[model samples]
Target: MRLLLVEDDPMIGEAVLELLRGERYAVDWVRDGDMADTALRSTAYDLVLLDLGLPRRDGLDVLRALRARRDRTPVLIATARDAVAQRVQGLDAGADDYVLKPYALDELLARIRALLRRAAGRAEPVYEHQGVSIDTVTREVRVHGQPVVLSAREWAVLEALLARPGRVLSRAQLEDKLYAWKDGISSNAVEVYIHGLRKKLGNELIQNVRGVGYLVPPA
Candidate 1:
């Protein structure tokens, strides 16, 4: 999945970025609310980690603008605010979830997964289509009760497809999910990953819509 992380603290931002990357998410990070707002307006993200205290612009204002523009992308507020009123204010301002600073990494990761799953309309952690099963928490894929090994890129492609089963995603969309803002991607990278996934999972698992894009049909 692709994520935008808006944080001003160098230590915190670097730590969170590395953790998200290790979880196989392509992340673009900004240190302030202005850049965060610009990135949100210009790019597509599966989720956002927003901090309330920001330079130039307040994160709450950015959230308000995002919701005003009808951008329903799931947002998790990560800040030092711990009061009940502050938490309520964040949720009232349109954050889907909130995490206090000095939080456990595991708990933060779990909340991220929960929000992503909810946004995808998935009630369960494991996604099953046809005979293939994917454990989102473990990053494991299995076919016909047997485990299947996939490279990180292949996993990213599959995750994007499974996140919205039956919804066709164009190559560009898939590429955005696979790459961060600074990463260089080849023109045919998405196709290559699709081909590899088909080989490992099965050709029928991912279907192409002529000139449009690709999707995984509902099980």
Candidate 2:
């Protein structure tokens, strides 16, 4: 999953970024609300971990602006204000979930998972198709009841494919998900990862269209 963490505190921001990245999430963090707004408007993220106390625009204004633009990306508010009214205000302003500051990392991860599930219109983190199962929360995959170990990049490639089964995904699209905007991507990196997944999951699992990109055939 990809996340945009909007936080200004260096200590908290670095901690959250490292923790989430360790959990296999591609995270882009911004210290101010202007950068957050730009990222929200420019990128496609699975979720946003927004800190309510922000520099420049404040988190409430950020949430309000996001809703005003009709951007439906799920947001989990992270704030030091633990009052009931404050939580209500965040939710009312369009936050999908709330996590008070000084929170447990596990709880924050849980909220992120919950919000992502809600965004995907699912109630669970496990994704199943064609006898292959992907545990989004665990970052595990199984095929034909056997565990399949994949490199981080390979796993990322497969998850992107599974996210939209039967729909052809261009190499550029896959690259976008695998890397941040500033990261350099090899032209054949997608092919390399696709080849790796095909070898692991069976060649029939993913199909290559001559002119289009790749697709995971519907079960």
Candidate 3:
């Protein structure tokens, strides 16, 4: 999934970015709230990891602006503020989840997964359609009970499709999800990954809607 990480602390930001990228998420990191706001407004992200204390503009204001524009992208607030009132305010400001600083990485990852699943309207960690299963927690894929290995790019495409089963996603949309802002993507990258996924999973798993794009049909 594509994510925007709004943080100013160098150590924390780098750590979080590395961890998320290790999980195969396309992440764009920004240090200031103004950049975060601009990125949130211009790009489509599956989730946002926002820090309340920011430069130029506060993260809460950025989130409020996002909601004001009817952009309901899920946001998880990560800040040093541990007070009950601060947590409540963050939620009231539209944060889907909150993680106080000095948190366990595992807990933060779990929260991120939860938020992503909730945003996709799924309550389960494992996504199963037909005979194929994807374990969001383990980042594993199985076809008919047999484990299948896929490249990082291929996995990104599959995750995007599975996130919204039966919903068509254009090539452009898939591309956006597969690449970070600074990453270079080839013109045929999405097609290549799609073809590779079909080979590893099965042709019938993902369907091309001709002019529309691709989707994983409900089983």
The C-alpha RMSD of each candidate to the native structure, in angstroms, is 0.7, 1.6, 0.8
Question: What is the C-alpha lDDT profile of model 2 across 124-196, one tens digit per residue?
Answer: 7888888888998888899988999998778877877787688798887777667765567787999999999
Q: How far is candidate 1 from the true structure (C-alpha RMSD, Å)?
A: 0.7
> Using Cα atoms with residue i matched to residue i, what is each candidate's TM-score against the true structure?
0.98, 0.93, 0.98
Q: Counting only residues 3 or more apart in sequence or on different chains, how many pairs clash (N, Cα, C under 3 Å) in candidate 3?
A: 0
Give the alpha carbon lDDT tens digit for every residue of 1-219 in model 3.
999999999999999999999999999999999999889878999999999999999989999999999998999999999999989999998889999988899999999999999999999999998889899999999999999999988998998899888899999999899899899989988999999999999899899999999999876
Q: For model 1, where is the 10-residue window of minimal lDDT?
A: 157-166
Mind sharing the TM-score for model 2? Answer: 0.93
Candidate 2: list runs displaced more than 4 Å: none
In model 2, where is the ten-residue run with the lowest total lDDT? 175-184
lDDT at 188, model 3: 88
Best by lDDT: 1
lDDT of 3 at 170: 96
- Residues 16-50 of candidate 1 have per-residue lDDT tens digits of 99999999999999999999999999999999999
Q: Score residue 123 of candidate 3 by CA lDDT.
A: 97
Model 1, position 196, has a per-residue lDDT of: 97
